[model samples]
Target chain A: MSDTGLNPDMVSSGGASAAPPLSRIQGVDKVFSNGTVALKNLNLDIGRHEFLSLLGPSGCGKSTALRLLAGLGEPSRGEIRWEGGAPATGSATDKGHRDIGFVFQEPTLMPWATVFGNVYLPLKLSGVSKAESVIPVGEALEMVGLTGFEKAYPRELSGGMKMRVSIARALVTRPKLLLMDEPFAALDEITRFKLNNDLLELWRQQNWTVVFVTHSVFESVYLSNRIVVMAARPGRVYEELEVDAPYPRGEDFRTSADYASHCRRASDALHGAINA
Target chain B: MTMSRPDDDEFIPLPGLTPAQKRERIARLVLPGLILGFAVLAWEIGVTVNEVPHYILPAPSLIAETLIKDWGTLYGSLLVTLQITFSALIVATLGGAGLAILFTQSKWVEISFFPFAVILQVTPVIAIAPLILIYVDTVQVALLICAWIVAFFPILSNTTLGLNSADHNLRNLFELYGATRWQTLLHLRLPAAMPYFLGGLKIAGGLSLIGAIVAEFAAGSAGSGSGLAYRILESGYRLNIPRMFAALFMISITGILIFMSFSLLNHVLLRRWHESAIKREN
Candidate 1:
């Protein structure tokens, strides 16, 4: 993907809101040292408690945008403002971690640690003693349906179970903002669907603002309230589509005409992005 | 629905070995033993049939006899060699790993001193033993320095690689979680480097033993307080081939024991996670 047409109006395109966003990406550009413009003039506003999906094909800077939101790296030109100006840095930098929990494309677990230990990591880093962390860690594991496997190592668990552990680890910190970069992309469909249901349940219950990045049209439509279709070559937003579906979306929703229409809309937008 | 969990209880000290794995483990021991038994038997028969002189080519039986007969003198030499080998290995472990940690903490330090470490490792310990002995007043200290140089590099290089090779994603996670530098080193880097450090320890164990013997030979320190190497040298000069073989046997046994212990340590430390230690069904 190469940078070509610069859409001036695309800057903060769909970010107009009454209440302040959980985080705002304004005129952000990420140009790597190798001179590949991963993102150019990208804009998005992650609202509180909204399941927003950054949908795009590969090289569309979807992950880059998510990382930028996480404060993983500085945007080449613009700025990402978390709620209340810049993030406060004490012990936890409030960057990619502190008030934010990030799940990468891979499970990214510490193989040597047990499931409990892996989940306990964020708490542990924040200076919570193991004794103090037991409740939160257990709750996280319980949420991910991995309570019984706390003693298990990553290698001993199946791929799906390992990913559950990763999810549990992300949830243990109980961050208001959860940034997932195609967390279920590597999973089989059955497991992915199960995790999607579980994740949606957790998001609804906890009221977390989740910015999920994925290319799967069906997954984006099924799990997200808002899907931002992004085009490649200096990744920029192409379209913002909303799924006005209610809570507790399950197998019925997955098979419904509503879900199909949403998927169709997202699929067409993605095709447009790929061809553009 | 619950996750598809493994049926076997994971915390079992020894996971129930599959029949194939059991058979493989048995063969690992029995096969080597069988071959060694036949070889020893052949040697015994060949010596008797040829009527070879004991001084030139002692039979296995004669070597065993010599080992038992010279137990007092040989045992003392064995202790001396053991002392030096273990001392060198312990010192090398601490020094090498400490230096590796230091090197990893600062790129400038590594760049400045890594070449010197390489020089010490590549140059033969035997070639430098005479100079060490001449410069150092204490023969034991000189031998230790020589053996230490021989055994130090593996731990240094392997640990450096291990510390640096911690999973990048995990490093990012640690940074994300605001893990302190000490916490990262202790929790992430140390555990990740364990298998590598154990691997280096195994190699250094054998190398230290070899270094001790080679350095002793170069020193040519005989009489009382001498190691097994001097005993072998003394036996050779006196044409006591059986005694020489007996000392050689002890050295071989010690080396095997060192390797086996380190292997056991590696297995115990990494059985739960590392691919090298885990027993796969496929």
Candidate 2:
């Protein structure tokens, strides 16, 4: 758990209770069809109930790593070993792994569906009827502070509200791991801050593992208990920083000297990774 | 701009139409009617003042009189033409959409059959109608085939494009959730394709009517169960120029009605979500 640990795949100190890692990416390499080396020898351990941010620049394969965790794509070289012997590699013939929820940078809602319908999608894919999903869907929306917007179409809502719906959809299934790829990057600063606070609050309450990919130092510092800075040109981990500050982090903590010091460290690591 | 209180978020009612919007709404209805009224009046005046013989160029009044005077025969023929048009449209919808789904399911199938669809689309229905009439046993079935041939291509092409156009992120989301292929098709692809399919339907509706009339002209089967086009042909032969104008008028009205009805259907289906159908604040 020490910062000076030599293993790049070491689990963060946030899960200090000695629970085994939820998943492990062991020597994963991703080479696209055009021979673009997206990831090179990537190794990381996702601790249970920990907010781990994969902070890096564009082309750093942070998103590629997230997608692999969600089984959206296969690693070209190595395997992701999940808990209890489940592997995260996708196969078209098998019923896909449903233990992961994902949020894209864009809201990515079904434009033709109502808010409830969009949020109910994961359960529906699992064969839960609409009549059966009302309570869980309502609860998910309420968790995101969007209860009254269940009937509104995505077009009628503001961008912030649409992203809220996207979050609600991701949370509805109550998945074990939530993978978010810069979900607030497209939003305004005020909205981004508000959502960041709400997301941290939700993560604390739900106790689900989250792997958030972002290029923003402040955002990574504010939300995550641990940050992994990754370098591009065949993306690999450069460094990991543990944000030792306590949680239930609020506006006061945001303005505190403690938060500034953590951001500065994360920013320095990020800059080093970018240069490397 | 007015500052809205945070508590008033639940029911931020849409503002009432401004004066300019009201004027625009009124002008939409009134302007078209006024121009049409003036044009008809001028035609009436020009015909009656010049004492032009009815055979050469029937006046508006004569055309209207002929419409009522021969409603029994004309109405029956109108029904016949409408039956062909609607029937062709329904069959075209089923066949075109079904084929498009099949095309999407397999690349090899699409590659094998798509060129035939393009060939059918590129060859003029008018040129093919005579050959179809020569082969098919019944003129009515031949007309239906021509109309269907004209209508189905747009639906197939548009629906294929729409199915392929589902958001890439959404598709990945569905895949992550372990959605079955059938579930993805039913929930995502079909609904996403609705607006495009409806656009194709609007175009097909009018084309079906045109195809029916053109096929009837080629058939020239004038004894009984003839459509409005046959009446048009018969009136022309007898020099009943006013009746010919009357029949032509019915065809125009029918075309307008088909286009308008399909357009209404499109708006109703997509008013809530689609950019083409939603009403923007500005």
By lDDT, the best candidate is 2
DockQ of each: 0.39, 0.40
lDDT of each: 0.84, 0.86
* lDDT (tens digit, per residue) of candidate 2 on A154-268: 8877788888889888888777789999999998888888888788878888888999999999999899888888889889887888887899898998899999998988888
RMSD of each: 3.6, 3.8
Give a tens-digit lDDT track for model 1, residues B81-196: 99999999999999999999999899999999999999999998889998998898888998898889999999999999999999988887887776788999999999999989
Q: Model 2 segments beyond 4 Å from truth?
A: A1-17, A87-98, B1-22, B221-225
Q: How close to the true structure is residue A170 of candidate 2, measured as C-alpha lDDT?
A: 87
Docking class of 1: acceptable
Q: What lDDT is reached at residue B85 by model 1?
A: 93
Cα error, candidate 2, residue A5 (Å): 8.0
- Docking quality of model 2: it rates as acceptable
TM-score of each: 0.94, 0.93
Winning candidate number (DockQ):
2
